[model samples]
Every structure is written in structure tokens, then in C-alpha cells.
Target: MWSDYLSAGFFKAFEASSGIKVNFTGIDSNEEIINKMKASKGRGIDICSPTNMRSPQWKNLELLQPFDYSKISTIKNANPAMLRVGHDEWNFGAKGSHWLPMIWGTEGIAWRTDQWAPPRAGDIPSYGDIWQSDVKGKTMMRVHSGMLGAGLYLETIGKLEPGAMKKAYDGEPGMRKTWQVVTDFCIANKKQVKLFWNDADSQKNGLLNDGVVVGQTWDGPPISMMNNDDPVQYRAPVEGALAWIDGMALSKQAENLDAVYEFLTYCYTPEVGGRSIDGGKDDSWGGKGHGYNSAVLGADQYASDDYGKTFGSVYPYKSLANLWPWPKEPQWYADVRTEYVNKFNAA
Candidate 1:
């Protein structure tokens, strides 16, 4: 999946000049990939792209190789938020550059323009809106446990209870309120929700087919849909959206060190970074080069024709600059996913 969109020509050009063949393999899921790496005793794969939340597993399994940034030149160009060298011990030692930030984005709402009015500036809708009877069956949401876990937080918004946030994160309070809101919305609007989607393509199709008036989705999908001639719009909402920072790291068992470095270097190059930000490709890996909005180009040469207006206004890059990155706690992910799944199932 990661290799399909990589500019073959760009890699081939690198190979022609560097005499290194990039051996790319496709894996079906994170679990399968982890199993394969473990089975190999950390000797097969050269590099791995894992969520920060999964770092503890890799560290505990001894599957990750400590990165030596002394050999890499692109680290200087990396965004400070994207770089996590000295943050903590689990983060590849304080100075060892094992994990390299790859992409960053937020999870938010995407709605059909035909069905909903454009939200006023600073008036973004939130999870609470999904429970409104008016739009009940008209909504769809991500079924992933990580995303649904956000519901627990949502339920505490208007409550007078103390420690609600901590309770939700701890999975004690559970996602009861969030589930109630979502289930009530879904049940009332049973006829409106055309389908629930687990993938981007499905969400786009739902929006296009008029199956869903609004849905919880990542920033990328709605942007891509609007670019593809769909009337979808995205918003961060008042409650704030979820953010993630995925990074790249070399495997402890990797045999092709030079090839791995070459690949990382290629990814960090200005051209590659620019293309990734401009939506030149689809995969999540490339999109991290630029910020959330497709309009902000690190290099002027890479900007699209309407870059000036489109990048800032539609995407809201300036506002996101101050937002915090998701914490790199593995247990947080586990707890959230579990609570989300439980609440979703109950709903």
C-alpha cells in the first residue's frame, strides 16, 4: 500500500544514480507486519512506519534498531514537532534518532455541502451535533476503536462531574455518554445513514451518493473529495479534534542499511516533501511533508497555481500550527480503542 503511490520514476532515478535497488514489500496489516518482523528475529525488514502509540511494543520486542542520525543529512530540515529525538527513553534514547516523524494530521468532521449549511467561521460543529435528532439517520462515523474512543471525551463536555477527562481516558467512566449520543443519532436517523464506512473510498462514495449528510473523518478525505468535485467540507469543531504524528524507523534486523538510509533520504528530500504536501500522491506517508492544508508548500516552486488563497483559507493551516500533537503513550491507544469498540457495540 505504501509503495504503490511512491513516484517509481523518482526511485528509479535514485537507483540509476546510487546503484541501490529499493526492495519494497506490501504488508496487509500492522499485526501481520509485526508478526513477520518477529518471526524473522528482526532480520528481514529494513524500516518500519508505526504509529507512536505502537512504539512500546516494538521497543519491548527489540524489533527496532537505534537510529544514528550522524549518517543522515535531512534531519536538519525536519519540523521540530515532527522530530522526537530527546523527548524520552522509549523514543530511541534521548539523542538516538531512531524514529523519524513521517506524517501528521487531525481527525474531524466531513459533511456534505448539499445537505448541511456551511459552518460560520469559528462556529464549527462538534460530536454533540451528531446526536441531534434533526440529522439523526443522516450521519455516519468511523468504527475504528481509536476514533470512537473520542466519544468518551465528548460525553463529558457539558457534564458537571469532576475528573471526567481522566475517567474517560482511564476507561472507568467508559464511553457511555458518547455512545448514547451516537446511538441515539443513529437510531433516530436509521433511514438516513446510508452506510458506515471503515475506509476513505467508502466514505467518499457515501458522500457522493447522498447516503450520509455528515460523518466523522480525517482531514484528508474531505479535502480529497472536494478536489475530486464532491461537495464535502471539513471542520475542526469547537471541542477540538484528534491529532496523530506517525514516524519512520529502521528495523533492528535489517540487512540493507544503505538501502534504508537511501529510502529515508529520498523521503526527506525537498522534492519528495513538496510533492507529498501538494497531494501529488494518495498514501498517508507522503501527505506529511506539508501541513494539513494542501495549500502550504515548503518551497515556492512546488506550490500549485492557486496556492496562495487555497492553502490557508480552506485548510486553516495557521490555526493548526498551535495545536498539540497526540501523546506517544501506547496504553492510551489501547484504552481508547477498547472503550470505543465497547461503546460502539453497545450502541
Candidate 2:
């Protein structure tokens, strides 16, 4: 779980009512949590917040239990767009039996507009922005071997054939070629990269301190910066933002299933979900400000409050066509990605 999601009073309010103590953990990325859950056999975890893309892999490992509608009373509030992304038979079962959509958002470029602006009038931003000569030596990028990096690569090079999502994770012959291209792209631009970051603070502060003119960030940090009058911008590139939804999953070995179920239901309520999205503590990114949007149905009501949008209040929701979740990857693909990640890090 991300601290950015579960804000200050979220659990305190829940505890005051339910008298249940939350033992929480913060995970860094999509890839790391999967490995952690599998290694622990999910011994200590009750509810897991993985993206819809992870449903297939979780199913393959039997890491999660099937959902039963009888246990969830709040399912009706989940809207269509939120439930539909990265969804499938295993996690959703016949009728969404395995998971509940928790938080959803896009990951893409966050740039310093004061330092880096469009090269020409009416020129839209794209993944190619980091490679521009003006922004060189002042760029950063996401360090991922999963869908985020792979999707950007495929989309950037116009190599996203149909089923390209699976190929991104599964190491199809196409994956090798696609990854090679991305690797080459990164290597050629590595000199421009100040750092490849996984820590949240580094990403947010890098932009805040003006360390890099352009780089990768989630929708949150940019919004946070702008709220404080920092001149940062997060936008969908010409290639489109990398979309994802993190949901609550049940661990097979969870000891207190009933309590965890109740907790999930409690959290789904609009007030709690809203507070969770817009929390008491301010991270460098959205919190007290909504860093990004959430999948919880009523949670997004704060769009009217308007965190830091100068273009207008609230994010202009993109077309469903523009978003893509991380592909559900197979084990073989995961292994190949690990190798590629190793090579990438070594480089």
C-alpha cells in the first residue's frame, strides 16, 4: 500500500469506529509487490492493492482467493470505467470475485514548464520530449522492466502490434526486439539522465528542486508542485499516458478474512475513499491534494475542489482509447524481464 493513498486520518477514523488496528506496509512498485507477496506466501498480508494488470499473474500463482459477491456489499458503487480496465476472468471470477478496484491513475512525463516548454506553438508533448536537444542533460526516466517501460517503447517506435500488451511482459520474439529498441534508446540517452529513481521523494523533489527539466512521474507530484506554485506539468504525451488501477485483493493465507473484508467495505465508502485520496498529510505530491485520481467511485468528487490545474479545474478524463494497463504477464515473461532488468541496471 502507498502512504500517499492511505492518508493520515484514514485508518484513525476507521479504528475509532471498528476498533481494528491496521498493520500496513508500503510497496514501491508493481513488480516488487508481486515478488514480495509470492515469497511470503502472503502470510502477513490480508488485502493486497495490485493493479488490474496483475490479476492474471496472481491467478496463475494462486496467490489470491476468488471473490464471492456475498461478501461485498459496496460493489454496486464501482463504476464501469473503473471496473473494466485490466480486468479478466480470474480476478473478477464470473462477477468480480477476486478483487475490488481501489485506486487508479496514469504514469507519464512530469516536466518543469518554467525550464522546459514546447518547442513550437501548438506542439503537443510526447515520449520523445526527453530526447529533445534542449532538455538533454536535464532528464530522468522511469526504471522499469514491466509494462510502463515496455508500453512506452512499443508506442514510441510504432511497434505496438495487436496483443502487444502480452508481448511486452511475455518475452515473445517481438518482446526481445521491442526491448532491444528501448534499451538502445535508454543507453543512447543515459548521459542525459540525472538518475533513474524508484523512491517517491526523489522523484517529487527532483522536479521540485529543478534538478531535471523533464522526466517521468505519476500524475500526483506534478499536481502537488503546482498547488504550491511550483511550475511543473503532468500531461499525456502524444503516445498517451500509461494507465493503471490498483485494487484490493485477498491473500489466501490471510488470518482474519472477515475483518479484512469489512475493512475493504469501509474504505470504499465515499468519505473514507475521498479522505484516502485527499489526505491530511501532504507528500511532495498529491495528498492533501489529490496527486492523481482514484478508482473508488465517489472518491473522485474532489475534482471540483481543483488541486492545481491552471488549464481548468479537474483532470480532463482521457478517452478509454488512450489508456493502457500493464499486461498480465506469464512467468516466463517475468523471468525474461528480470534478465533484461539486470542488463538494464548494469548498463
Candidate 3:
């Protein structure tokens, strides 16, 4: 897993300098993280990364605790907007932040550069493009998120009301109504997708080996390939990229308090945070960072030469302002979406 590689890289760097060994267990999904933490009562793990949207549920479940920011001087180096998320959104019963922003990223369009390009030069592609007739059976997507992308595309053509997808987060009825249209659209155009990707490796394989010409993929995989001079490019879609922040949270039953704080301080250092963006010179793990933005201020200054060029190209001409952050999701919402996703897949 890319996350495991990231944890390994961090462990190697921190261990070499601090003389403290860190053990890592990689999990593929948020559900797995919740399950493990719940089963252990958060006893075994010192820290775990969960998306910002999961903060509320996790906090309500008493799985995590607020951080003692006094020990983390590097907290001053984080972006203020991101800090507000920890302070305002994830502050569930605690007066302080239960979550600390780490890696932030987006999910958008990626295509084989030699085999495909946007319809017009200088313009970005749209989620609707994935279902275009020309690319039938040559596209790929993860079903759940892809369905949301499809919903956005439907609104663009007057097939659904504007903002219908975002409105679904209001409650269960809205969610079902919105997802019903999305599910129908996906079932009708299911033939367009060559394969469904569930992980980073599957996404890369779809493009590099499985004949996927274009895909709705997380920016990391294709950007990493692009850095290696592979004929692939990832960009924000015309509707907007789906954005998210993945953060570190303290386990409720955490025993290694000193080590947890030490690791947090190490992660926020400018040089370390920067290396995470550019995937530092560590050859053992393919020397590739996760290819996402870091939350730490000044971290970009320490990134590789390719970082600046790639950033400017991928988010050109004010596209950054258009990022659509994922909203906080309740357990009920997740369960409802799972039903629709299952229906679309089963179709």
C-alpha cells in the first residue's frame, strides 16, 4: 500500500535521527481503522490517519483524544485554514483539536497522454467525459466516487438539478433521491468503464497495463507516473476536483504518549513535510512521495524540482479555488451510499 510505504519512509527517517524505532501497521480503508481501534479500544496503536470527514463519528465513539498542542511547536508552521478544520470541525467534546491535518489531496481525471487528451486544447476535462462514446470500454473508476462524479456530470447537462449531489448530505431522503439518479446513469453507461479500481496499484495497472485510456483516479498515482516520465497526466476536472484532508489522531487508549508527540513533532518539520510531497531520495520505496499537497507551511520550499512545475500545470488558471471538499459524513450517510454503490455494481 502507498500509505504503508509512506509510513515506512517516515519511520526510516525518524528512526535514523531520533534513535527511536516505530512500528507501523497499514490499513486500506477507514472502516478497517475503525474496526481495529474499536476492537482494541484504541490500546495498541499510538496514532492512525483518518480523513477529516470521519472525525465526528470517531470522536463520538470515544476512539480518539484531543492533542496537547503545547508539545508540538511546529504547529505554528501549518496552514491556518487547515488548522481551523482541526479547531472548529473536529473539536467534538474536547476543547482542543482531536485531529491534526497531515496530507491533503484530490481525486480527478487521469489519462494516458499519448492515447488521449482533453477535447479542446487549453481547456480541462469534465467528469462527463468519462462516459463519452469515444472512450467506451477504455475508462476506469472506483464505483462509489465515480458515481458521485457521474452525478455532477448529470447536473451539467440539465439531467439533474444543480447542487443535487451536495444537497444529498442533508439527510437520508435527499441522499436516496440523488443517488437513485446517479445509480441509474452509472448502470446505463457501465459499459464505458473497462475496469473498476479499488486501490492505488489497481489504478496504475489499469492505465499502464490494462488498456485504460482515461480514468477517474486519485491524483497521486498518475502524478507519480508523470514524475517518472510515464505518458500519463492528472488534472482537476472542469466541474472541480474532489478534495480531502487525511489527518493524524491520537488513540484514546494510547500508551506511548511521549513517542506519539515525538512523531507528530517530526512530521511537522519543514524538511520532513516537504520530502513527503516530493517522495524524497529514499530508493527503497520507489523514491516517490504520495504526490499530494502537504499542510505544513514552507514545506514546498524543500520539495524537489518537479514539484513546482507539476503543481502549476495540474491546477492552472484559478482551478485551485474550485476544489470541492468532501463534506462531513455521518454513519447513516455512509451506510446509505454503500447500498447505492452495491446496486450500481450489481447492475
Candidate 4:
């Protein structure tokens, strides 16, 4: 089972071809999925999808089995650049094996273009827009693994030194003050946030139905709103978008192993992946780059025209340089961020 945000539904074509009834489970955040894996002891779940940022935590816990590239024939079609960006395989595992990139995207402010404009503003949206005095009681944000909010808060206070962020995730010296700044900002502006969301529907509802003018959000909700004729836009804030990749991983002890492996490779198929996003366009014109791309072969052919105009995609799939994924660290930073969130939620 996997998160619904990865794809609208499991690929029926794969099921049709393999005669395997693909079972899927959906959740909003990586932390929730991690908790599920822990509670279940990763039993019965043949395969699962998790944001690549969580890969470090998963691998450290030995929660996932080594993905044998020697056997998964379909891996030949995957993006070569993404083969193994992290992990010290030789010492870490038999070969330091782990998950693969399923889909990639960024987190940013989803604004109602009709409701607010940039301060200096023709069109480019900035992360600071969410903190303006006029927007009080009408903004929202998300707790996507703790980093997205950290990025925004750090940028807001001018403490976004790259090395400082790495230290922040690592819980090093001086990072505590930075973390305190963020936590204090959170307490101060708790009332400014109309809501904090974790799933797609909450964000979609917060923006579309609940009168939220500007909120920290993922790319999907704003695009879904646009498709429904809502004037909305998702963009990389001036501080930059928080980029991360999501992909599938096999549990160490899974039933139906053969079917699980088949489903893993089947998902990378271009027709299946491309069609799943952007309402089945399966073409370059799919709804504005979607901020994600397949890790498999022929993914380059699906780049978006709207996003390509701004280099969101190239001949091959890629994320913008300004987009930052999670900082590499041994400890899962969500443990820290969730502490802050719990207090805020209690308020």
C-alpha cells in the first residue's frame, strides 16, 4: 500500500496485466506512515511509498529490505542520476541498498491570486507574503516532515545559512537558538494561521472552501483548484521551495513477495506514471510540470510546457536548484518538529 498523493489511484493496467489486485493505503504525511510501519511492525505490507527524505530514518531502522537491482528488470529504465544519491552502501548494508525515487515535488505557498498579490508584486510570490500584517487570521501552513516550516521560518528571520540548517537538523550547538527562534515565531503567529494541514484534501478545503487566502501547501492542491476553475497558483517562494522525492520500498518481511516486486516495477512504466498525474494527459502538456516526474525511462518526454517556460523541467526530469530537500542527518527531524506542532495543536 502507498500514499494517495503519489498517484490518484493504483495503476489498473498493472493489475490487468499481472492479475494482481493491487491494494493501496493512503495517508497524509510521512510521519504518519512511519508510525503505521512501526505499529504494524511492517507486517503484511508487501511494499510502501515514503518520501525519500524519510529514507535515512527507514534505512537506519532496518525497516526496509535491500532493493535488489540485479533482479528488478524494470530498474534499467529508471533515471540514472537518481540511482544512489545517498547512503554508504558497502558499510551500511550488504550493498547499502534502500528505496528508489517514485516521484519528486516542492512545498510552497498556495495563494489565491484573486485574493492577494505580492508586496512589490507583479506575479512572483514570496514566502514572506504569508507573514504580512493584512493577512492575519487567513493564512495556513503545513507540517510536512518539519523541514518546510523550518525553511520558511529560518528565511523569515535571516538565519538560513546552509550550514546552519544542516546543524539544525543535526541538533548541533547554536542550532538551538535557531530552533528557539522558529518555535517562538510559531507561538507568536499561531493565530495568524487559519489551519495547519497534512493531507491534500485539508489544504484543498482550507484554500478553496475555508477562505484561506495564503497557506503553505503542496503543488497538487493549487493545481486541483485551478482545474476546478479556482484562480490559484503554486510557486517556489523567494526563500525557495522545499524539494523532496517520494518512492516505493519493500518491507523486510512481506507476504506476496512476487506480486509486490511486480507492482514495484510496474509503477515506473511511463504510460502508467504519466497518465496517473495531470488527469491522464500522459503527454508534455500535463498540468504545468506537476512539480514531480517519473524516476523511470522516457520521463523526460513528459515535461510540462508551463513549467518548462520557467525550467521546472528539462529534456530530462529535474528539480529547480533553488528547491531544497531535507538536510541529510541521522536523526529523523520530525521528532523535533512534531514537538512544536503538538504544542501549537493544543492551542
Q: Which candidate is the best by TM-score?
A: 3
**Residue-level lDDT tens digits of model 2 in 200-280:** 667787887748888767766676566666777776655566777777778888899788867877866765665555552
Give the deviation of candidate 3 from the true structure as CA RMSD: 2.0
Clashes in predicted model 4: 1
What's the distance in Å from true for residue 228, model 4? Answer: 4.3
Against the true structure, candidate 3 has what lDDT? Answer: 0.85
Which order, best to worst by TM-score? Answer: 3, 4, 2, 1
Q: What order do candidates take by lDDT, descending?
A: 3, 2, 4, 1
Worst 10 residues of 3 by lDDT: 1-10
- The whole-model lDDT of each prediction reads 0.56, 0.65, 0.85, 0.63
Which residue pairs clash in candidate 2?
67-97, 67-98, 92-96, 92-97, 220-291, 286-291
Candidate 2 structure lDDT:
0.65
Model 3 lDDT tens row, 1-347: 13532745666778987888877777666777788888998888889888888775676788788999999978888788998899988887756898888888899999999999989667588898899999999999988889999999899999889999999999999889889989999999899999998778888899999999998999888888888899998999988999998888898888999888888888888888888776654454346577888898989987777799999888877789999889998888889999999998898
Candidates 2 and 3 compared by TM-score, better number: 3
Better of 1 and 2 by TM-score: 2
Count of steric clashes across candidates, in order: 5, 6, 1, 1
Give the TM-scores of the predictions, in the order they appear.
0.74, 0.84, 0.95, 0.84
Candidate 1 segments exceeding 4 Å error: 1-43, 85-95, 118-123, 145-167, 170-194, 279-301, 305-308, 314-324, 332-336, 339-343
